[model samples]
Target: AVAFCESVQPLEAVVSLMAQRLALAEDVARYKWNQKVEIEDSAREQMIITKLKAQAVAEGLPEAWSETFFKAQIAASKATQKQLFAEWQQHHAAAFEGVPDLNSQTRPKLYALMSELITALHQAWQPLQQPECQPVVDKLVREKLAKPGYKVAGEPLFAVH
Candidate 1:
C-alpha cells in the first residue's frame, strides 16, 4: 500500500490545488461583484479548457480525460462562487472595498494553480487506474485534505468510476 499511496500523491496534490482554487473563488466573487461582472464567463472557460487539453496531450495524458477533469474543477469553482454570491446577497453584505483586479491578481494565481494541477495529473494518470487507487484516495482525502470553506461535492474527478 506504500507504493499505492505514493502513486496517488500527485492526485492528492491536484485535489489540494482545487481546494485552494475554490478558496480563491471567494476573492474572485467579491471582485466580480464589485466590478459588476458576471461569474460565468463561457468564453474564458472555453479558452482554459482548450489550453488544458493541449497541455494534457503534450504531457502524455489523454486529452478527453484531462478535459473532463478540468471541467469538474471549473464546475466546482463556479459552484463555490455562486454559493458565496448568494450568501453575500442574502446577508445584504456591503460592497467589498478595494477589491484586487481579477485579471492581474486573481487570474494569475489561478493560472499558476492550473499549471500545477496539470503537472500533477500527468504524474498521476497511469497510477490512478490501479485498483488500490480509489481506496487510497478516499483515505487521503478524508485524512489529509483541507476544508477550504466550501464543500467538495460531485464525483471524484480522477477516480476510476
Candidate 2:
C-alpha cells in the first residue's frame, strides 16, 4: 500500500506541502510560493554569487572564460549573421528583379561591398569555429558552406603562412 501510494503520488504533491501552510490555495499558491522562494534565494545569494563571478574573471579561468566568451560571441554572431543575411537577401532580391550590373566606373564600389561581406562572414564564422568553440561554430560553418557558391577549403581558416 505504501509503495503503491508513493508510486502514484505526483512530485508536485510533495512540493506543495509547505505552501499549504502559508494560507495560499494549493495549486496557485504553490507556483507563487515557488517563484518567491526562488527570487528570495537569488537575492540572498547575490553578493556571494557576484563575488564568485568576479573571482572567475580575475582568475582567467579557461572554462568559465570560454563559456562567457562563447555567449558573447554567440550574441555578436547572431547580429552579424542577421546583417550579412539581410545584405545577401537584398542583393539576391535585386538580382532577381533584374537590377543592372554596375558600369566600369561603379565596379570598384560593388567589388568593395562584396569583399567586405565576405570578410564579415569569415570574421563571424572563424572565431566560432576555433577549437574552443568548435562544436557550435563548426556546425554553423558547415550549414553556411553547404549553400551553392560558398567555397570552403581544408587549410587553416586564418593566415599563419
Candidate 3:
C-alpha cells in the first residue's frame, strides 16, 4: 500500500510559486507602461532561459524539461502583462506612481522564487511521472492560478502522463 506521504502531493507548492511569479506581472506592466517599453523582451527571456538551463542539471532537473517549463512561464507572464496593459489602456490609466523598480526590487523577488522552484521541482521529479499528475496539475491550476494564461503554464508535468 502507498504510504500516507505517497498518497499526498506537494505539487501545490509548485503551483503557488508559479502564481506568485505571475503576480509580479502587474508591477512589471506598470513599470513598462510608464517607461514605454514593450512587454516582450526577447533578449531578457533568452538570458533567463539560458541561465536556468545551465542550473537545471545541478538542481536535478532535465535541461530540456526546464527549458520548456521556463518558456511556458515566460509566455504566461508576458500574456498577463499584455492583458493588464490592454485593460489600463482601455481605461486611459494614468502613470502609476509608487511602482517598484523593476530592476532591483521585482527581479530580485523573481530570482528568489526561481531558486525555491528549482528545489521544489527536484523534489517533485518522481511524483510528476505518476498517472495522478495530470489531475493534480489541473486541480492546482484551477484553484491556485485560475487564470487563462496559467492554464497554458500548468500542463502535463512530464511526458509520462
In order, the Cα lDDT scores of the candidates are 0.73, 0.30, 0.79
What are the clashing pairs of model 2? Answer: none
- Give the per-residue lDDT of model 1 (tens digit) for 1-161: 25444476676776677677766877899998887789999999999999878987888877777777777677777887888788888998888987878999999998888888878866776666776676766665555443333235225453543
lDDT of residue 117 for candidate 2: 29
In the range 44-149, model 3's lDDT, one tens digit per residue, is: 8898889988887787787878888888888888889988998999999999999999999998888788778878777777667766565676677878764657
Q: Work out the TM-score per prediction.
A: 0.83, 0.24, 0.90
Among all windows of ten consecutive residues in candidate 1, which has the lowest summed lDDT? Answer: 145-154
Q: Candidate 3, clashing residue pairs?
A: none
Candidate 1 versus the native: TM-score? 0.83
Candidate 3 has a TM-score of: 0.90
Clashes found in each candidate (C-alpha, N, C closer than 3 A): 0, 0, 0
Give residue 151's lDDT in candidate 3 (0 to 100). Answer: 68
Which of candidates 2 and 3 is the stronger one according to TM-score?
3
**How many angstroms is residue 126 displaced in model 2 relative to the true structure, after the best TM-score fit?**
8.6
